[model samples]
Target: MGMEDRCLPGGKHKASPSPEGHLGTCHLYRENSCCSPDVIQDLTKANDIYWNRCGNLSSRCEDYLQQVECFYRCSPIAAQWPHPKRPTAVLAVPFCQNFCDEWYDACKEDLTCARNWLTDWHWGPEGNNCNRECISYGQMYKDGKELCETIWDDSFAVSTDPCECLTLSASDTGFSASRSRHEDSDSIEEPETPKKDSRRSGRKGLCPGSPLLHRLKKNLRKRSVFMEDVEGSGSGF
Candidate 1:
């Protein structure tokens, strides 16, 4: 997977943003994003990640996980740090101290068996299965920094300077697109309001629901092909 603009290969992302917000779980990337509505539906069904194998997580912990999922699955900025060989993966993604701390605090009580979720798990044709002893998150990583920096290998680089970091939130659009995360910046601008187009609102009746998802899937099947971005495939985040 050679470097590409705003989208890594082997994922259900747009070659470029489709100029409209998607519905359901991935709506955070609504403003000039990559993933589509069908991708959101696909994500909702992905229940085999090792993080959940220990048991259910606290709601607060789950929200943070959702935010991380939003970034890995939907955010266009993810493309900036593409993995060396995996077109569907990213490395050294810019993240903020506040988020890491908050996420660690939220999930510190949650149980996890592996230090690295990707490799520590036992993998097979079915899905990833736990391979190690289950223990509290507090016991696995020293702190938030270690959790973020170590969990996915070199996948995320945490920033101390708050303004120069990525939030993985709706406000992320305010973050300058052209600036490299490694560069110094003193401030983060406010997100600009997107002008409403009656033509775009409601997706012209393509609202979020199973009905819309089914319709989209049906039409795509009729085409007998997948979009190039959707062709990107990998094992995990």
Candidate 2:
């Protein structure tokens, strides 16, 4: 198949905007507008040369340089295309991270190129932003897991798997945990103090079920009172 034909499976073309108004389709344009005829020919010739040279290598060691060179030659092709939309990145990064992790785990023992490729993508300055975003997302997920564990322990009479609690509505819980602290910070306001003694006492069990909830509430209330007292005393000076 020609380079344009091989660019997509079954010669399928991705749609692009054009001056004529209706959707336009071209394999080379879909790959990248920068993929001029000369560039396409050069890349194809390079691919052929590399494969002919390395296709029959007896060992991976002999193929390593050729593989690296081929990747180096091809990597620039990605830059020729426009960056993916932010929404697309947001949707795709998690799946990509999981795929990388799974592939690395299964192949790292024997595939030097695969290991190097992952490491380079994660650590190289040009490519690390996506990986960094994935890392931040992973940390938020860990935080959400911890939050679920805390809630599970506080609400249940007997021990249960925190992960099982997570499975009830994992995505919603994870998203809430990720955004909760920022939302709380932005929405902070002074708490209203209760006037009645019984109402004040009832506040000791902020959460339902666990006996420890009262103690947790009491400690938090004590800290709030101390801060209030300090603010009042400072205002007198």
Candidate 3:
């Protein structure tokens, strides 16, 4: 949307002091009784009577005027943005993602550059070097095994040591040599493989093949057990 189309009076510079005797085409003039001012003289009178004494606007009328002022102020931001406007029918609607695609497309390039910077600063997914959860993370179980296909592969193995790979805090337990020793030994002894067990009926041996599924399953089981205890306690009450 153009800046002119977004602002009140449809252009810059506010409406030209309302033509001679007319109240100019502001939406407020038609709906608000107090907005009957057409000239500087009338504005002075309004300022003396309704403004200083009776309040600038009645509670009923203030909302409409405030909304207009807010929209006028915010329209510049909306115009500066390249995202497509929501359709007029849905403009007043809330909590809708209808314009997300347009907004995402407009901001995608900047977001990608930011993510890259985070990667360099050791805050990105690539910087974590977490082969399990990082690489094997999937949107859902139904997203398929392909989501975890890149995990635990030779390509994911970095030539540099963990601490050298990223500037992590020496105090962080996970970044310590002892943590590395524990992880390496555990991975070697357990082989970090899937349990090959079934959780759903008629889905025999159809669990996630990714080792990250172990942590995911453990978390889910813990949550389930926690909820069960809560329910049991509530029942006793």
Candidate 4:
């Protein structure tokens, strides 16, 4: 399948991405999408135990969770790492360090009933039931690397590359086809550590791989707009 047409297995998604709007929280894909409006509605009120496996989740934690769900269900670029055994299913999706670290930190204290969320659930007619005791994310994994690597049964791995991976943000919408081709592999190499440095420097006026930089740029844009308005009013310095 072509890069613009890769959707998840089953009839859950459209064959190719198209325009969709009024999708509530999944509005990221309003311009182009695979998920139907109903699917996106279900996402906002989703009850897959992925977010509430423990109980009410912190907004920060759930924000990160919903990000992954949006990427998997709506983003056309996600299927680049198609599973070897299941052509329709995505696996080993490469995530950038900035995204994983922010996700892990937000949910670090949140509870979960499974280490491998893909396999630990006992699915029934209604939904999945947990077989293990719920535990905090801090207790479940050593750090962000372990959390991202283990949560989805190796469906995700962190890439050290600063601008070549997904941060699961709106800034990531520019994923390039030439940069995503991958050879099937069973194991992902360990993610390397980030060099201590400033968050200011990045290519393309933004770094899509780093959530910190993404937020920073967003604020900067807002500030620039505010200043422009101020200048138009001939305000004092």
Q: TM-score rank, highest first? A: 4, 1, 2, 3
- Global fold similarity of model 3 (TM-score): 0.16
Residue 237 of model 1 has an lDDT of 34
Per-residue lDDT tens digits for candidate 2, residues 1-237, read 212112211111122211112112112122223222333333323322322221232343223233222222222221212224421111111111222232223222232111112232333433222222212212322322232222112221212322111111111011111232223222322233223212212122123433223333343454456667887886775
Per-candidate count of clashing residue pairs (backbone under 3 Å): 3, 0, 0, 0
Residue-level lDDT tens digits of model 3 in 1-237: 323233233222232222123334232222111222332223312212221121233342333223223222222222222323421101211111212122223222221111111122223432322112211112211121221112111111121222111110111101111223223222322111122211111212113443323433343354456657887786776
Name every residue pair that clashes in candidate 4. Answer: none
User: What lDDT is reached at residue 30 by model 2?
Assistant: 25
What TM-score do all the candidates reach, one by one?
0.68, 0.17, 0.16, 0.70
Predictions: Cα RMSD each: 14.6, 24.0, 28.6, 12.7
| CA deviation > 4 Å runs, candidate 1 | 1-5, 42-50, 175-188, 192-237
Alpha carbon lDDT of residue 114, candidate 3? 15
Candidate 4 weakest ten by summed lDDT: 183-192
TM-score of 2: 0.17
Best by lDDT: 4
Worst 10 residues of 2 by lDDT: 87-96
